[model samples]
Target chain A: MSLAVQPIDDSETINPEAVRRDFPIFSGSTQPRRFHYLDHAATTPKPSAVINSISDCYAQCYAPIHRGLYPMAEQATSNYEHARRTLQHFIGAASPDELVFTRSATEAINMVASGWLKPRLERGDVVWVSRMEHHSNYLPWQLVCQEQQAQLRFIELTEDGQLDLDGTPELFAERTKFIAITHVSNVLGTENPVATLCTTAREYGIPVLVDAAQSVSHIELDVAEMCCDFLAFSAHKMFGPTGIGLLYGRQERLAEMAPLQVGGGMVDSVGDGMEESRWAAIPARFEAGSPDMPGAVGFAAAADYLSSLGHERVHRHIVSLTRLAAQRLMRIDGIRLLPHAGLPASGIVSFTHHNMHPHDMAQIAGEAGVAIRAGHHCAQPLLRRLGLTATARASFSVYNDESDIDALIDAIISAQRVFCE
Target chain B: MIAQDLYKETLLEHYRHPKNRCDGPIQDADAVERGANPRCGDEIEIGIFLQDENIRHVQFRGRGCAICIASASMLTEAVAGLSVAGTRILCEQMHDWFGDIEPAAGALLPNGLQALAAVRQHPARQKCVLLSWEALADAIDKAGRE
Candidate 1:
């Protein structure tokens, strides 16, 4: 199969107003004012194209895949495989067979830890992760290490909240068998240099898993260039539906791994005895059962929607909004933005007020029809490392404009006035 | 007016000048307990000095939202002079105050707790208003066991 890159028009400009119209949730509401949605890091609102694709699948071509010889079943199977290929190209994977569909990014990480790495690891082996990883990326390694009597190590963050690259070499000594880290932090908005980290881990014969849950929507990913052995991400974080996630692994590593779930669809041949049974092929072996067909259709639609917009343009738009929000939010008195080093924040800005609690701030923001997230953001260890219990976060997406940032700033000021006075 | 209605003047006053916000655990308290809202990381520790089956003194130390801190500050004042049985009744009343049904006739709330009625409008924050009272109940339970 030819893996050719699609041609994109570099000079195309993105009109966020036009893009906002593609999402019905923004306009169908009866509210007097527009809702300022700044929580894209949690989940994105679905576009009309993705929604229509899902409904069309159920209405026109609803059937079980890979089983029936009838026309409907064949259409469903083709659509599902096409969705896989679309995602494969989206992430620049070597082949569609490298991608395995899981329930979510959390389940994808769990599969790698239990099925791929657990059987190969020995007692006293070490798994290294960064301090800024979301709990979904951190807890799987922690649990597997505990169960296997292996050690779990953390690559600490510097004072500016980037990965402490200077202190990382000491944590990657001989016993380090696997390295799991996030490509971008959900809370601190720090984008780690995964390519550099992968190159270093490859030198030590260590397999690395990149959690791209926060990066796939904003940054273009190429697994070959990244040189990481495995990668995981969820579709919901992007513009697709929930309950669908993707895991990409190097062909050689995936070939050696066992299936996490053994079921009807995953069996190549079956007999009464276990010795007579063999698992299915690469992607099918991991999929295990009837797949989420509608989700796959929606996922492909989301991929097409983003591709049409061009990821380069998307990156520029989100980064510009993040920088603007950070600058304006910093001007507010008693509001402190979490420090980042040289790398700019990728569509997220987390902060705290010296006088008001984050929950109160978020509540006030919500009252003004602005949606933001407040709490530990499932990165309690990272917050504890920073000596903070909670922080308010405003994240951006392609549909978010400058007015959203203004609303967030106004809400913060309102909270300050209500509490500090 | 709307802002003051949410963060009422009485509530803000109590938050600014908390009655029994202390530096450490009460040195001579008979019972101590801690409560935390894991979702938001709001935590509070309550200590009670019980003498002659009455709450002689109550002190709290922790970090939390304004609603939680104010509720704790007001809680310390409300339960300080009450008998152990009366404290238990107040705990029951606090739980009832959060319910959809109103308190029965003649079931009066303590004076300072009225400010927290505003919390009912923000259902997401009811937990914040109840954190300190929950800790007080836990301390009373520990004292009973002792």
Candidate 2:
């Protein structure tokens, strides 16, 4: 397939042309338009720096960390820990120990469910989760609630797609034990008022866990400023390699939670005189297996890449592009943008066509070399609440510019002609 | 404008005006089966009526994409009036077609059903085409057991 390399608009704070050069997928294309990747919410394409970091780790410094005494092992171990420190500073964590690496954001939330919430939750307690949570954030709590015989309730969304924060204060009853919510809605791209929700939860003496999977790539995150007890995000969403997720727990909270998995690297000592083995330190204890060494190296590079780009610039690009896309989509006949009540700055726009199915819309877009996600997007509850079975979703990232949205609009119009004409 | 081969005019016509689509569950059906693609949340409830060891009638009800709905519409028309065993064979042949396994030299898919085969290149959409057929297959099995 030939690529259509359109001229980039340099008016934006983050220049898509310069950023696209960093991402190898858009590097060699001279054609006007070949591939318009608008599925950034699903996962971002890795930059050269992140890709090279993973390659360098394996080709030059590959080793099983913490087990080897040799220099290579030490180097791998140092790099892994160095990545942790880099991430700690990236998210504005008070200490590196607050960060625990898991396989995915789903795993991080599961660890919290099984290790932290399970023990403290009583049968009569209630866990309040927002309706906008992706299954990764919702299902874990549902399973834990079912297991513990605890009551699970939802923090409903307003028609405009914002979290119904107005009703939150009264919902935090005495029996409310915890609140888990997302920083942004994966489907609507609505950046929920998490800081306000976190503050409200604190007043009720209930700790909150913020699902930062969508927000981490688009916004600047400071765990201290956010005032959440725990935060979860995935590296893949931020142009890093997959199979690595970060869970940041406040020191006191991490101390109270037991290790989700106990084995090799996470044990302080075992098989001594005592029957019970002492677990390792906070972050180490949570991470039981040999770590994803290359993943950590790549993740650090991704954090550094985003750092260099600056969140302000990234957020501005996303907001401006998303607003533009939404406006253009709205202008098209028979197209209904989800949560038309308000626009989001989070760089995602979901919509449904009156005549065409989302799957068909997405497929037609794909044929035009525009990559947009379709269907429930793993937030079925939110979609159901919006009276939709599925919708076409176009998400933006730092590398995206006006041309991508133009391609998406052309695809949508083409789909309308195909289905409605 | 480039033609969307996947959403051919024929398929879109079938989607716009689905045949044998019931507003609600089919009553007096010999057997019924529900098929769902949880990945995309496409669901189809298909029912079959058997008379003299043949599928006398078939009907489906569901909500899904154009491909899924159109495929279901075409499925009901394709399998109607075929013997129970004949319908099962057709379903198997259709699955093979989608899987890119060429049918036996003499075997060819029915003319209308062949239109849905455009989804073969789009693996994700193949499930949409097959959702109703799988349900029809299970519905037949359910009838046989009874």
Candidate 3:
């Protein structure tokens, strides 16, 4: 199940300016600020095509799917299911039936924790999660572990914030039944060695879940290649609409799992007796209500947009920008990039100012129309480990340019003048 | 321009040299309350020493943004001689002051709380300005119970 890597013509180059033009938010009457959107890790703005697709679904092909018999209904159903197939190919899943539509990456994790892990776990079982996981990935497992009286263990991070893979042998002792880790640290931007981790977990017969919310857009993901049993991500993070997320599980694993929700579209039949209800097959069983058809259409459009750009091009562009940004930002007085010695981090550059609070820095930057995120970034534990209360993060996407980084640096300098000088 | 207005010279002065920022909890404090802005990890622990319903001494201990720390410092100085009821009124007044300021108009707030007026422009940061006041309110409630 290899991912379709579009051949990159050496003659061609990615024009971020051209990419930026595709997004209406960058050049519209209703545009917010100078729109140096450095907070791509938070949510990327929708491109015109994705936005148009969503509007087209609602306007031309609007109807309740999976139940209605009208032409509009059939069109809606086809469009919605077509998005599933697009996503299935996007992540290199074995089949569309293995994909479940969730509200967000947070809900996708909750679905796996509650539906799959809870029923099989015993009191003394252990679930190993990495310290760098976002709260979305951490809290669900914590809740499930607490409910099932299972121990939740954290794989310690190295001094540079990368996962300590060397320490894996001791951590994967017999009781470790499950492993949940992030493909990339949202705070540090360190891409974990997930393939190796998956391979290790497989040897121990431990099921692994990859939280790819941060990596789906930035990295070319192939769930089959990673060999992880489950993966979760959101569309909004990748320039699609909100309220649509993907939960990819291996077919065998999904078949063994019970549904997180049981209602309308998810039930094959509700028996006269309360205990005799039969669940629908794989993906449908997990998606209980009327799906976000328009959102699905938008998500597919986003996938198509990315595919057209080619992940190789996106990766190269971001990596180059990240390295340049990191080098430039590090030169500024009082700026400290989170230490990393392994493979260079992704497009995210999280740092703190010595003389100012991150919120203050962000506020100053915001006034200058440079949008960067400040705070723990829903990864409080990681910040605590880094000896920081909060940090201002400037994350990049395909749309971001070198000028955005310059604006961020200029904003930081200006903030220092106001706060420190 | 807006950023400078938010972190005024006076506010930074207070933040750098906070008034009544104690090393430990106030000795034999009547009330102690800890307030945190969970989103940004800003924390403030306030201690109040009350004598006959009057705030005899108020001290804050913790770290946060300039707005939060400055607000706490200014709040302690403002309410040092006020009764618990007076402090409550001041809290309400502060809330109204921020609430009343127009987003576009950079109006002057009352003397002690003028630094926080800029928070009204940045709605997301309003919590940083109010963290100390919330802790003070909690301290007052705990003091009243005692």
Candidate 4:
């Protein structure tokens, strides 16, 4: 593949004032000495396009969508259904029938824990998962296996944060049910070879479910080409609304999967007896109660906004920022940057100061107007593996500029000098 | 600068040239207490020289963030001539002192126990400053427990 380099006039590519004007929150913030935002892996800031979509949906059409018999309801239903189609196209899905909407990626994982994979899976069936998986992907199987009397296996990661392909000799066995892995490491910023991992899992006839929470916004994803059976991601992490996420399962697989929660909007008909009710087909089977139509509309708008900026452009910009941040951080005295920090890192830069507590470092950075995440970052297993209680993390996103990286480095050095001197 | 600047100066002095920062000889020691902050991987050992039921001397040995090591040194100096009740009151007073100061008060502690004042500006560093004291507290608690 020929690597393409876009010219950096910087001015034409991004209008600084226009970009700042888009987000109302930025208007009130002090702007500090230099407000460096490097926590994009946790959650992204939505643009005016997404903000307006939600507001417009509430202002003009705020009614029940599928069940109502009114004009606003018809328009709401049209927009909501169109969102499914939009997401389906975004991820290169074959049809909208495969998309199941849920509150967040955590809830989506729980749904699979109860609905599709759990009932069919029996005790002693081995589920292969990666060590680098976020708690969202790791904990569900832990709980599921505890109740079902099943077993969970862990795949090792190399020093560079990539999956150690040669170490997985146990993957080609009859006992293996499915392999669950994260597409990118939220802490390490390491990208996984999903297409390759998915293809290998198929050799043993095992389906793969990818935790695409970190990968969705950073890289171009083609679920059909990746050949995975299921994918889960949240919109909030991708410059979209919260309380809404997408669970992409293959049409054939979703057709047979059971529903985790059964309630209104999910049922075709119900008898006097509770157990005798018939559920709706495919996508509706997993969706229970009223959907977040307004949030979904905003999410759809977010998807469009990101696409307009060009996903490839966003990827290039963030990769460059990650490289710059990692290089600067690693050069600091007594600081150790974690493995796999680069141009296309998971968009996170994790480091530890020799004798400094991450919490203390975060506090200093906070005082410096440089915001970085501290502590275990909800990846306690990974932390325990590394024998650390906490770490300082600086993550980057599209809105972040080169000066942000400089600000973080400057703040860190100043903090070091302040305490060390 | 606030009176706490005095504390910051004390912390910098003790951290730079730490006093009572070594273990007492076994011949001169009663018992040693070991403590660690699992969060930041800081460890401290408290060696107390006691006479009958009263405290005669106190010292600390640890490797951790500068705040912790300095606080341990200053704490040793503050409680050197005090009774067990006096030491406990000092610890409580130090906690309140840290709570009362402002960041602009400067990095130094205001009073004689000024080495601990940097902790006031850094709420997150309070644990670091209190680690040795907590170990000392636990040592006393264990001595009483025994």
Model 1 chain A lowest lDDT segment of ten: A1-10
Q: Give me the displacement of residue A358 in model 4, in angstroms.
A: 2.6
For model 2, residues B1-112, the per-residue Cα lDDT tens digits are: 4555777778888888989888977888999899998777789999998898899999999888889999999988888889989999988887777766764411487888
* Interface C-alpha root-mean-square deviation of candidate 2: 1.9
User: What is the per-residue lDDT of model 4 for residues A1-421, given as tens digits with 9 covering 90 to 100?
Assistant: 0012122333325444455566655555666344676777788777888888899999988889788888888989988988888888778899989899889998888787667778867899888888777889999888888788889888877777677878988775788877888898888888888898898777767888888999788687789899898899999998899899999998887886888898989989898956688899879888899989988888777777666666776777777778888887888898987767644465788998875667657766776677898767767777777767678899887777878877788778766765656
Provide fnat values for all models in the order shown: 0.61, 0.50, 0.69, 0.19
Task: Quote each prediction's TM-score.
Answer: 0.94, 0.93, 0.93, 0.82
For residues A320-419, what per-residue lDDT tens digits would candidate 2 score against the true structure?
Answer: 8999999999999999988842376688999988877888888888878899999899998887787777888999998888999889999999888877
- Model 1 misplacement above 4 A: A1-12, A273-276, A341-343, B1-6, B96-108, B121-123
Our model 1 lands, by Cα RMSD against the true structure, at 2.5
**Which 10-residue window of candidate 3 chain B scores lowest in summed lDDT?**
B101-110
lDDT of 1 by residue, A1-421 (tens): 1223342445656688988999988988565689999999999999998999999999999999989899999999999998899889888888999999999999999999998889988899999999999999999999999999999999998889889879877665899999999999999889999998998889888999999999989898899999999999998988999999989999998997878898968898897866678889999999988999899878878877887777888988998889999889888899888878123569889999899999989988988889999999999989988888999999999988988988999999888877888
> How do these models rank on lDDT, best leading?
1, 2, 3, 4
The clash count for each model shown is 0, 7, 0, 15
lDDT string for model 3 (A311-400, tens) is 888888887887788888888899887766123468788888788899988988887989899988999877777777788888888878
Chain A (alone) TM-scores for all candidate structures = 0.96, 0.95, 0.96, 0.94
Q: What is candidate 4's TM-score for chain A?
A: 0.94
lDDT of each: 0.88, 0.87, 0.85, 0.76
Tell me which of candidates 3 and 4 scores higher on lDDT: 3
What is the per-residue lDDT of model 1 for residues B1-146, given as tens digits with 9 covering 90 to 100? 33556677888888888898898766778988999998888999999998898999999998888889999999999888899999998887887786635545114887778888878777778888888889999999999998
